[model samples]
Target: MKKILRVFAALAPLLLAACAPTQLVRNKGDAAALAQQAAREQKLANANHWVLEGKLGVSNGQDAGSGGFTWTQDGNHYEFVFRTPITGKSYRLTGSPDGAELDGADGGPQRGPDAEALMRRALHWEVPLDELRAWVLGLRAQGADAELSFGNDRLPSMLQQDGWTVTYPLWDTTRQPPLPAKVFAEKPPYKVKLAIQSWTMQ
Candidate 1:
């Protein structure tokens, strides 16, 4: 009985911690400092190349799908791959300022002007690929106006950019340049969510 009581007591704090809200902002006054910190983080992200592996879910009002996702970004170039387990099929999309291309195992590469547009046509997923270049790095897309909301940890909790709203619920602090682990972004008629399992930076 005493041993059981002791065990319960020892686990109480952890249980509470797990239940506590992660997005609570205890110090609203820290917004400025947080913004500055975020800017520094963004700079680091933009000046370097990175890769992310994750699970992705997309919904477009009338349809929904999920798959394994991988993205590699270097300077102005990027390659995004998605594999759907059920169909045993993979899709690859590569893009740069020059243009975008989509290829599959059964078909030749198709070129398009924009990655997002290519995705909509090829995969029917309305992902905001251009804005995601910045959003994936926890920053608003360059040259676009945005509104940001910060959490207690002085990181972005939510961001409203262009026509989308992005939320950051978890950050992977273990990495050299901490990255977002779970990101959800949505706009009317389209929604996408990513749970990043790995991050590699160069």
Candidate 2:
């Protein structure tokens, strides 16, 4: 008995340390709940018409593109339009909830992933895009989950809820029928910044 007690005493510090609490690692359940809450908030914020404007910056390089956008959601269909620095072309794309190809600037069909996909591919950074658009439009994602948090900015900020830290900068205007300003996802590995300026509801 004395021998056993001595052995336990010698190991107590290691046992206590193994059970230490940590705040950095986010729980999956909690993260999902946060996403659901954010979806609810976003859907409520969605309207027929809203305006937005902001810049997108990258880490490895620098990119600033700002333009006006219009999204019309009818049933499960969505129509989007935008004008930016990357393309002088004003693209109007309409597609269904599922993977459907629409008018694309490259003379190709805009499909799964969509413009954001191309942007992510170009920037070489992985981001929660589907969630981003939903969040930007203030709607819930059709398939993927999301994360939302309030940030201190000239507008509102929503940090990632996916256990990954992707800080999104936003500005919520106090318009009867609330509206979202620019929603940005600033990533690391060269400092990536993607912004959706001016989102107007048709």
Candidate 3:
């Protein structure tokens, strides 16, 4: 009986340790920040009609290009124009829910079912225009899961979605609801950087 009691006493601590609940470490501020972000997103969701003027830089680990751009969005329709300073050439991409068209490429004009495919086929640029429209505004794109890290300002410091990592280094707080001033997105060899000069929201 003494030997059995010694063995049982030794196993008691192990059994209690195994039955103990696990402790979870969490940051209390994270929940508040996420709620703020959600509210911001809701406020900006209806801000679809706007014009953004900026400088765009794109690279594919080999070829690179930088140009001034004007993006005008009206609900489901959008028009994006790019002007190259060095080449003095201009390209315009316009589309709606129907289809997309890319004008002023190497060839005459290219038409496709979507902007992403049209851009890739016409300009050899691998940019996700559908997702970018939302990301440019510091909001996560629809139809995809995203992971966001908040900065000290409670704004998003980094956002990862659709296989791309986007970082907002600056924000225009002067606006009613702050907007991203500089949006940089990268996925491996492909990188797209935008330095927004001005924003006109309607």
RMSD of each: 11.3, 17.5, 19.9
- Candidate 1: clashing pairs of residues: none
Instruction: Flag the better candidate by lDDT, 1 or 2.
Output: 1
- Give each model a TM-score: 0.80, 0.47, 0.84
Worst 10 contiguous positions by lDDT, candidate 1: 1-10
Question: What tens digits encode model 1's per-residue C-alpha lDDT throughout 1-202?
Answer: 1232232233333332442335445333375757665665656755548788987777676566666789998889888998765555678999889999998733467789888887777666689888887788777777789887777667677888988988887888775456778788889888777878888887
Which has the greatest lDDT?
A: 3
The C-alpha stretches of model 3 lying farther than 4 A from their native spots are: 1-29
What order do you get sorting by TM-score, best first? Answer: 3, 1, 2
Write candidate 2's Cα lDDT for 94-117 as tens digits: 555464444534435546645455
Off by over 4 Å in 2: 1-67, 85-87, 102-104, 107-129, 137-148, 151-156, 163-170, 176-178, 187-202
Per-residue lDDT tens digits for candidate 3, residues 43-74, read 99888899999877766665566677999999
Please report how far candidate 2 places residue 180 from its true position, in Å.
2.6
Off by over 4 Å in 1: 1-32, 35-39, 42-45, 105-108
A best-first ranking of the candidates according to their lDDT comes to 3, 1, 2
Q: Each candidate's lDDT (Cα)? A: 0.72, 0.43, 0.79
Q: Which candidate wins on TM-score?
A: 3
